[model samples]
Target: MNSISYFLQPDSILFNSQDIDFKMPFGATACGEEITFNILTEVSINCLDVRLILKNGKESEFKLYKKKEKKIRDRDYIVWSLHFKTPSLPKTLFYHFKFLIGNSNSIFYYGNNSLGLGGVGSIYENHPIDYQITLFYKNNPSPKWFKESIAYQIFPDRFCNANRDGKLNATKENSFIYGRWNDKPMYIKNSKGEIVRWDFFGGNLKGITQNIGYLKDLNVGTLYLNPIFEATSNHRYDTTNYHNIDPILGTLKDFKEMVRECKQRGICTILDGVFNHTGKDSIYFKDASRSTKSPFYSWYRFKEYPYDYDSWWGIKDLPCVNELEPSFFKYIVEGENSVVNHWMKTGIKGWRLDVADELPSFFIENFRYKCKKIDSDAIIIGEVWEDASNKISYGQRREYFNGKQLDSVMNYPLRTYLLNFYNGSIDSETLLKYMNSLRENYPAENYFSNYNLLSSHDVKRIKTSVKDIVKCFNIDTQLQGAAVTRVLKSLSLIQFTLPGVPVIYYGDEVGLEGGKDPDNRRTYPWGSEDSNLLKWYQKITSLRYNSKILKKGEVKFFSPHPDVFGYIRYLPNTNDFIGVISNRSPYKSKFFKLNLKELVGQFSNNITTDIYLWNESLIVPIDSSTDFPIKIPPLKTLLFSSKSV
Candidate 1:
C-alpha cells in the first residue's frame, strides 16, 4: 500500500521471483551458487538503465544488461537480465531492482508483491521493498530417519495412566490430582494470576508404554515428548534438574523402558531440552541463592546477591541462566557425562529445544556438534514460530539453517496460514505464494525435515478452531446453516500430504477441542473419541506411511481458483504421482478442472486413480490433461493418487 503513483505508471515494469523464468534457483540456495534475475519493461517506458541493489553487510549495486525485446499481448517489451553468484560467506541476500525510465530521469523500483507474499511484485516510485534469498552451507543434509518419519507430540501429565491400581507416581508436594481421568484441566491461580499449585492428570511413561501398540497402529514413527525432567510446574519447562525424570511421571528406569519400547517398535524419541532457564527452586539456583561464593554463582546474573535476578521474560519463578557460562556450558554439552549426552545415552533419538530464539548461536552450534558426535543419525529441532531463515533475536541474525545449527524449525507459519486458508481469510493464490515463498527461502535439506503441525500444546485444537456449521455459497442454499463436519478432516489430510514431517498433537486426531494453554492441554478423552475423525486420521496416515512418493517425491503447487489450493507429489522421471485439491471457502464449493498436462505429460492422458470421498472411498479415473472435472465440496478436500494406490 503506501504507493506513490507520480513518476509514471506502476505496472510498467514486471518481475516476480516465484516464477523460474524471472528468478532461477528459486528461494534459498547454497553459498557460491549461481542465480539469474530477469525483469520486463513495456516498450513505451523508455527505460535507460537497470540496476540490482543488494544489501548484505552493506549496500551494493550491479548493472543488468539488456537481453532482448519481445512482443507480448500485442505489445513490445524490453527484457533485462543479470547473472550473479552468491558470496562465499553464508548470509541472507536482500535485493530489489531499479529502473531509470523516460527522459525525466525518474527512477522507479520493482520489488516484492504489495502484500509481501512474494510471487509477482509491484512497481514502486518510492520506498521499494527488498526480496530475500537465503544462502546456506551446501553439504549439510538432515538425517534420513527424520525426513521420512511422521512425528507425534505428547504432553505427559495428560496423555494416560496405565497403573492397574490407578495411583499417582511419587506425587509432588504442591500439586492436586484430578479425581476423574476425563476432568478438564483447571489451573490453580492466585491473585497475581500465578499458578500456586500445579495440577496433575496422572498420565505417565507407563501409560505411553501401554499405548505403544496404539501408536504403532496409528502409524506414528516419531514421538516428540514434552519436558520430562524434574520441575516445579506441570509442564516441566522450568527445570529443577535435567538428570531426573519428573517423579510424578515415573522414575529414570521408567523413561528408559519407554524409550526401549519405542525403539523396538521402530519409533524414535525426541526430548524437550529447556536450556534458557531453570526453576528458581532448582538445586543450582538454591545454592547460588545463599552466599556469593557458590560454585554456580557465575551461572546466573544477580542484581543483589541472588534475591533479584534475570528470569525468562521477567517471570520471577524461572531464573534465566547464562547459557554460555563456562561451568554451565560444560555441564550441558562439554563431556560424555554432560546433560545432552547423558540423555542421549538413554536411547532418545533427538532434542526439541525450547525458546530457541533466546539461546545464543554459539551454544546451539556446540549443542549440535556434540550431539552429532555421539550419534550422527540423531536430529535437533528448534521451537521457532516465525520464518527461521532470517530470524533476528536479541539484535543478532541467527544462522540456524546454514548447515551448522538446527536440522529443522517448529513451522508455526504453516499452522497460521493453513488455518487462515481454511477460514477463507486468504485466497488460494495467496496461499500458494506464501508456501512458495517459504520453499524459496529455506534450503531443501531443512524444508523436507520441517516439523509441520496444524495445532500444538501452545494453541487451540484444530477442531475447535475450524469446526463450524455455516451457510453455503449458492444463492438458493445460503438461507440456513448446513451441519456438515469436514473442516478438521480436510485440514489434517492437507497436513499429512504436505512436504515435511507431519506431527500430530496429543489429542488432535481424536477430535479433542479447546482454546489457549491450560485448555489446549486437555487429557485425551480415552473411550469417547470421535470415531469418524479418528478413522479419517488413520486412513490418511496409512496412505502416507505406504507411499514413497508422498515422503520424498518432488512437489509443485497450483491454485486454479482463489478458493482452491492444490499440489502434486511425484517421483522424478516418471508419471507416478499423488494430487490434492482443497476448497477452503466456507460457503462456496467449486468444481475444479486441474491442469497438469505439462507435469504429467501428454501420454498419460487417461489416469487411473482412487479419489478419497472423505468419509467414503471410491475409484475414480481422472484425466491428467485438465479436461476431467473434479468436484470439490465446500469446506472439504479431495485427494486422488495414481501410483500411491
Candidate 2:
C-alpha cells in the first residue's frame, strides 16, 4: 500500500471518487524514509504542476503521471512521487500540497491533509500546504518497561501455592508459614476478632517460575512481583537486606534461575525497588537502635528516644534512609554490581520504583544512569501518580524528560479520569479536562509509551468502583447489573483503544472486583473466571496489537463535546489505520459532528470500516456533510478503519 494518501475537498463519498493522491515509502534509512506522495484528483480543467511542502525546511516536487492500474480494492488513486528524509535535525514538519494552474502563481492550498480531514484543508484560498510532522528515530527503546509492557502484577504469596509440602510454624507470633522459603512469608491473625491477615500462603519464587507460561497465556510479557527483598513483613516493602533475595523468596541461585527462565520466554521481570525507608527490625536499623558503637548508626537520623527517630511520614515502624549520606548511597546505587546493577546483571529487566516521589531526584537520575550503563534497555518506572511533568516530588521538582531520570511514570491522571468517567464520578467535563491535561503535559512519544491502567494493586478495580457507588447510594434497583456492565464495557473499549500501552492488572481481565489495598489484593480466582468479560478483554487485546495506528500514531482531538468525544489516530506512514469515536452517554448523541480529516491522512469520502469487525455489519460510511454526523449509540465506542465499510 502507498504510504502517503491525500484527498481534496468538496466531494461526496470522498473515498469512492478518482479524486485523491497516494505515495509509497522511499529513500528509507534507520532514522526514517521518504514517502512518494501521489495525486488522485480528477479534473477536466487543465492543471500545471502539483507539489508537496514538507513541515521541515525541505520541499519535494510531485510529478504527475498517466493513470494506471494500481488499485488495492475497488478504488484507485492518481500517482505522484517525492522523497523525504525524516529530518537531518530536530523540529516538526508538516506535509501539504500546492497546485499551480499554468504557472500563474495562483497556489491551491492543500493543508496537512496528512492526518485526517477536519480543519486540515486550506483555511486560506491561496495558502501553501501544511501537515505537522514531528521527527522521531527508530532505535531508542523506552527506559520504562512497565509503560511499554503488558504487566501482570502479582502479590507473590497469594498467586499460587506451588508446593504442598510446606508448613507453617503455628507457635510463632505474627508469622504464618515455616520452611516455605520464597516470596510467601506468613499470615498472622490479630488477637481481636478481626483477622490481621497479611500472612503468606507458601507461594515462592519457584511457584512463580512454574507459572511463567500461565502469565504468557494472558498476554503478559512483563511480571511485576511485589517486593522480594529480605524483609520482616509478609509484603516485604520494608527492606532488611538490599543485596540478598529474601530467603523465603528463594536463594539468589533460585532467583537467577527464574530470571533466566523469564528471559528465555520473552518475559521481563520488574522487582519492586523500595528505597524510601526500612523496617525497624532491618539490619541497619536494628544496629542503629542497639547502640552508638554500631557503624550503621550514622546511616539513620535519631534523637533521645524511639519517638525522635527519623521516619517516613512519622511512621516509626519504617525509618527513612538518609540519602545525604554518601556511604548508604554507594551501598545502594554505586557499589560494584550493587542492588540496581546486580539485579540487572541477573537478567531482571527493570525496577518499579516504590514512592519515587520521596526518593531524591539526583539519586534516581544516578540510579537510572547506572542501570543504563549496565544495560541500555534496562527500564526504570517511577510511581509518581500525578502528571509527572507538573509533579514535584520530595519537596523539590523532578523532571523526567530531562533525559536522566525515569523513562516514564505511571499515568495516574489518565487512570483516574477514565475510572471517574466510567463510574460516573463526575461528568464528561472532567474527562475532557484530564484528556487535555494529558496531551499538554506528556510528550507524544512518551504518551504512547506511558503505562495506561484502569486499576492496579493500589486502587479498587473499575467494576468495584461502579458497584460500590451503586451499593453506597442505595441505587441498586435503579441501575441494574446489565446497566453497569454496559457502561463498563463501553469504557473498557475506550481504555483498550486509546493512546499509551493498556495494562490489565492480574485478575482485572477476569472481572474480579474488590476495593482498595488488601481487599484489592485478593487471591486470583483461578478457574472461576468471568467468561464474558475475559473474552471481551481478549478481543480488546487482539484489536490493540492488530492496529498499527492504535499502537503508534499521532492523536488528534476534535470538537470535544460534553456528551461525545471524538478523536482520530493516524499513522501517516502506514496504509492501515482508523478513527476512534466514542459516546460517553447512554443515549444516542445527535447534532454531533465528528471531524475525520484531523487525522494524519485525508479521506475524500468519510466512509470507513472496522478492521476487526469487517464482516460483522457494524461498518458505517460517512455522510455527505463536510464533518461526519455520527449517530453513536449510548455507552458505545466506535472504530473506523480506512478500508471497506
Candidate 3:
C-alpha cells in the first residue's frame, strides 16, 4: 500500500496526496470560506467494518463526515470533504488533524511492524493539517465625519516659510529658507564633495497660520504636526524644553493664533510630544552633566562610559532621561505650568506621543490622567509599531489598549504587511492571518483609532517597491525622477479605505517619493502636484467619511486568492456596504468567488445594497444572491452604501 502525505505553510495553504490522487486548497482562492476534507483507504475484505475519522485540535469543535466509498481491485478508497465555519479564530490557536482508522482487532501497518504506525507514518508525523483563522469585516467602510474630514501631517519646520514679510533670508541655502531664528544644526557630509547639513527648513507657527485657508480648501479637519517643543536639528525628537515651542519654529504667541483660526474652521490640532528622551544640549541635560551638585542632576543617569557618559541608542546627541524621578515627572508632567496642561490651555485638541514604548506604563497612565484633567475628550495617540494592545517596547510590556493610556496607535504592522503583500513577498492569506492575530490583542474601539499608514518619514516611499525609474511607466527624462502615478494612486486607494484611520504623510497625497531619514523628510512640494492621485485620495476620503457601513460596520472577510481579495461591511442596524474586490494584477473585472456567508449571520443576500460607481456618489441596485459574484478591477477599491442594511 502507498502512503498518504500532507504539508502546509503556516496559515497559508494546505496540500494532501493519497495513492494516485492529490488535493489542495489555495489560500488566496478560498479566503473567508469553509473547506472540507474526506479521505478513505480500504481495509481487508470485511474484517470488522471500521470508519475513517479525523480529529482537529483538542479544543477545536471541528467535525468531519465521509462521502461515497469506492473500490478498485484489492483496495477500497473512502472520500470525504472537511466542512466547518470559522470566520474568526483566536490568535494563539494552532490546528492539526489526526486520522484514526481501524477496529479493535484490526491492525494498522506502515513500512514495517518494528516501527509502529503510531510513531512512523502517524498523522502527527506524516500529515499536519493547515488551518487558518480569519476575521471578516466590511471593506472600505465610510462613517460620516471621517470622509469629509481631511487629515494633514505637518513636519513643522519644513511645512512653511514663517517670515512675516514673506521675504526669503539671503543667508539660507538654495535648498532651504531659514525663518526668523537661527536654529542649531547638526551637519554631516554626504556622498558629494560639499558638506551636507541637517538644518531647519524654517517653517513655523506663523507660516502654518498664514496657510490655514489653503488647508481648509483641502477640506482638512485634522492637523497633525511633528514636535514643536524647543529642540535641536530638523526632526525635533530630542526635546530641550517641553514647556515652550522652539523659537526657530515660532513664538508661543504664533501657536496661539494658529490654534484659534483652526478652531473657527472646525479643524482639530494634534501636537507631537516626545516624552522618551532629551537632547544633550537641553537645559535639563546641561545642568545634569555639569555636576551631581546641579539641582537637575537627578533628572538623568550619568554612568561613566569610557571617559564621559552614556546616551540613547549610543548616540551622544540623545540622552535618556529618568522618567521614574518624581521631581522630574512633576517638572515635565506638572511643573509650575504642566506641559500637557499648557498646550491644552492653548487650544490643542490632542497629542501624538513619540516613542511611547520607551516610557514606563505608569508614566503614560499618569500622562493620560493629566491630559484628561485638562480636556477629557482630548485624543492621545501613541507611536507604536505593533499591536498597541500587546505592544512590547524597551524590553517591557505596554498595556495601552485597556482604555487607559492611548486613544489610538500608529498601525505599523498593518502598513508593513500590506506593503509586503502588494510587493508579492507574501499573499493575502498571510495578511488575513496576521490581521486576525492583531485584532486579538486590541480592543474593538481601537480599530477606529488605528492610524493606518503606508509611507512616513521613517521609511522609503511606496512607489519604489513596484519598479525602478523608467521601468513601469513611460517617463520623459526632462521631467526627471521616476513616474509611477498609476501604482501610487492604486496603493493610495487601498491605504485610505482600509479598516483604520488612514493617516496621510504630508505631501504623500501629491505623489511625492523619497528615501529614508532626511530624504524622506523633504519639504512639501507646494508647487508641482500629482493632481490625478490627489483627486483619487479626495474621492476615497469623501466616500469613507459619508458612509456609516465603512466607518463602523462589521467586517466580513472573503477568502483571498493569489490574484484577488474581497470583503464586505454590514451595518446590522443601518445599510450594508461592499468592498468591490481589488487585486494587484493589472486585469480588469476579474471574477473572485468565495462563500462570504461561511459564518452565516454576518453577511447574506437578505442584506443588500446598490453597487457604488467609481468617481461618483450614485448607487445601482446589486443583487448579491442567486447570480451576483464579486468582481474587482486591478489597482482599484469600490465602496457601495445603501440607505438600508
Candidate 4:
C-alpha cells in the first residue's frame, strides 16, 4: 500500500474576495459583501472540490470555477477559488477547507495553522484544520487619532504628588492614607478575610497636570488612567459614583484642568469604565440593597435581598450589575445624560471598558454607538486578556474587532509571549510564531491600534520579571541589577517597535519593580529615579515618534538562530524601513547575519551604508549589501534604519 501525499500553498489561500495582489482586511465585515475562499495546490488532479466546514458540525460546499494553471517560485500550481455571501447579523463562523482529491474518495484539509509555511498533512493522519471568520454589521470606525498614537498607562493613585505638602482632600470611610510616599502597599486581610482598610498615597489629578511637561518630554500621545471615578478602593475597579472624581484623587475642577493641561501637552486621556459592576457602597447599590422597591433595584440581581447577590468574582464589595437591565443600560449607555456621553463631553478622549468579556455584545455595541454619537473621534478599548479576534465569552462569541464594539484591546498575548522569550522560557521561533499568529488573526487596523503593553497595574513589572529570570528558568540564582536593566532595555525596544500603540505602564519607564496586583500598583518614585532607565525610555520613545515606519509599517520576522529574534518594519510604497534585532541569550554574545533580501525583498538593494545602533548610540557606515552581520551583546537589542542610496 502506498501513502497519499497532498500539497497546498497556505500563502495562496485567500478569504472574502481577496487575492494575492490584495490582502484581506482584518476583523469582521458587512453582511452584503461576498465572502470568498481561494486555494492553490501543486498536486495534479482533474477533479478537486472544496467544502467549508462550519462550527456546530455543519458543512457548506463551495462551487469551484475558473481554474487556472500558474507558476510561482519556479513551481507549477493550480489555483481554485470559491465565493459566498456573508450571513446577516453578528456571529462568528468557524470553518476549514476540505478538498476532494481526484475521484479516489481521498480528502485534504487546510486550516489557518495548516495553511501556513511548512504546513502539510493527510486528512486522516492529522486533526482537521479549524479556521474562524467573524461576520458582523458595519458601524462607525475607531477614531483615527487613537490608531496613530502611542499610549501611556498611568495608575493615578501612584503616579505623582502635586502639592508636595502631602495631603489628601478626603479619604473613603475606613480607609487610611499612607504618610510615607515610598511605602510599599499592604495586602493584609482582617479576621473575617475582609480588607478592613484601604490605603491611598495622595497622587491626584493635580499631580498629573503638574507633570505634563514630563509626559510631553517622553513623547506620550495618549494617557490611559486607571479609574479616577469616585471609588473607595485605591485601585478603583469598584466604582462608587460614575459622575464624580474620587475625593481623595481630585475634584471635578481639578480633573477638567488636568485634561486641559494634558491636551495642551498633546496628550489625550482615556478613563477606565467599570460599567459591569459598582462598589456595594455606591448610592445606587446601597438603595437597592436597602429595599427591593428602590428605583435601582433592577440594577442588581439578588437571590435573597441584600445579603446574597451576584458580585464580580464573588467579591461582595464589588456588586456586579445587570448590564442589560433597562434603567441601568439607559443610565450607563443610552440616556441623554449617559455616563459614556457625559465623560466624553468632559474632554477625555476615550474609555477602556473594564472586564469587557462579562459585558454583553449588545451593551458594548450600544456604548460604542453612543460614544461616537457624542464624539466621532472617541476611541473605545476593551480589557480583553485573550486574542480579541474570535474570542468567546460566556459561551457566546464576541464581536470585539467588528468595527462596532472595541477599537482595540490590550495585547496580553504578545506581552506574555515576549516576556517568556526574554525570560528564556521560550526561544525566538516560538516567540515569532505567537506574534505572527496575532498579526495574521487581527484586522490590520486593530493590529496597529492594539495596546501593546510591557507592564501594567495587573501584572508584575517587566523589570521585576527580568530580574527574576532564575524563577522563569527554574534556576536558584538571581539576576544582577545591571543584567536585568539590560534585558529590560531590549524588551522595551521590541515593545516600542512592534505594531500597535506602545503603552508605558506608569513607572515602568523608570525601572519600577514589583510582583502582582497591589505590589504592581506602587507609588511612582519621584525625585529618586533610575537615570539610565529613564534615558533609555526617553530615547526609544523619541525614536518611535521620529520614525513613521515604526508606528505604521508592516512587520516581517527574520532570525538566524533560536536565541536571536530580528524583524523589519517597512511600508509598502516607501523606501523607509526600520530593522530591530535582539539577542535574548544571557550567556554569550553572538554575531547575527541578517538576510535583507529575504526580509525586505526588492528594497534590500536600496539600503544605504549608514547603520544606527540604538544601544551604543552610534551610527556606523557599512556595505549596502543583501546580507549584513553585526555583533549583538548578550541580553541587548539593536535597532537600525534603512536609508535609500
Give the candidate number with the greatest lDDT. 1
lDDT of 2 by residue, 107-193 (tens): 454553322221213322454444333333444557544444566777776566555665421221465443433232223545753
lDDT per residue (tens digit) for residues 1-645 in model 1 = 356455455557778787788899877888998999888888887999999999998999999999999887787889999998899888988999888987567777888876666778788777888898888888878999889989999999989998887788878887888899888898899999988998888889999999999898779999999999999888998899888888889998999999999999999999999999999888889998986899888899999765899999999888999999999999999955899879999999889999999999899989998889889988999999998988999998888998889999999999898877866678888888888878888899999999998888898877767643233233244332232357677778888888899999988888798888899999999999988778878888898898898899878888888888988887776657777888776666788555556545432444443332332365555444444467887777887766425
Question: Could you list the CA RMSD of all candidates, in the order they appear?
Answer: 2.8, 11.5, 9.6, 3.7
Model 2 CA lDDT for position 47: 40
| TM-score of predicted structure 2 | 0.70
Q: What RMSD value applies to candidate 1?
A: 2.8
Each prediction's TM-score against the native?
Answer: 0.94, 0.70, 0.72, 0.91
Q: What tens digits encode model 3's per-residue C-alpha lDDT throughout 312-413? A: 777777888788788778876877576776888999878888888888878887888787777766777888886665445766545566456676788888
The TM-score measured for candidate 1 stands at 0.94
TM-score pick, better of 3 and 4: 4
Instruction: Give the Cα-based TM-score of candidate 3 against the true structure.
Output: 0.72
User: Pairing residues by index, what is the TM-score of model 4?
Assistant: 0.91
Which residue runs of candidate 4 sit more than 4 Å off their true CA positions?
A: 1-37, 44-48, 54-58, 70-77, 83-91, 102-104, 114-127, 134-140, 470-479, 602-613
Q: What lDDT, from 0 to 1, does candidate 1 have?
A: 0.84
For model 2, give the RMSD to the true fold.
11.5
lDDT of 3 at 251: 76
- On TM-score, the leading prediction is 1
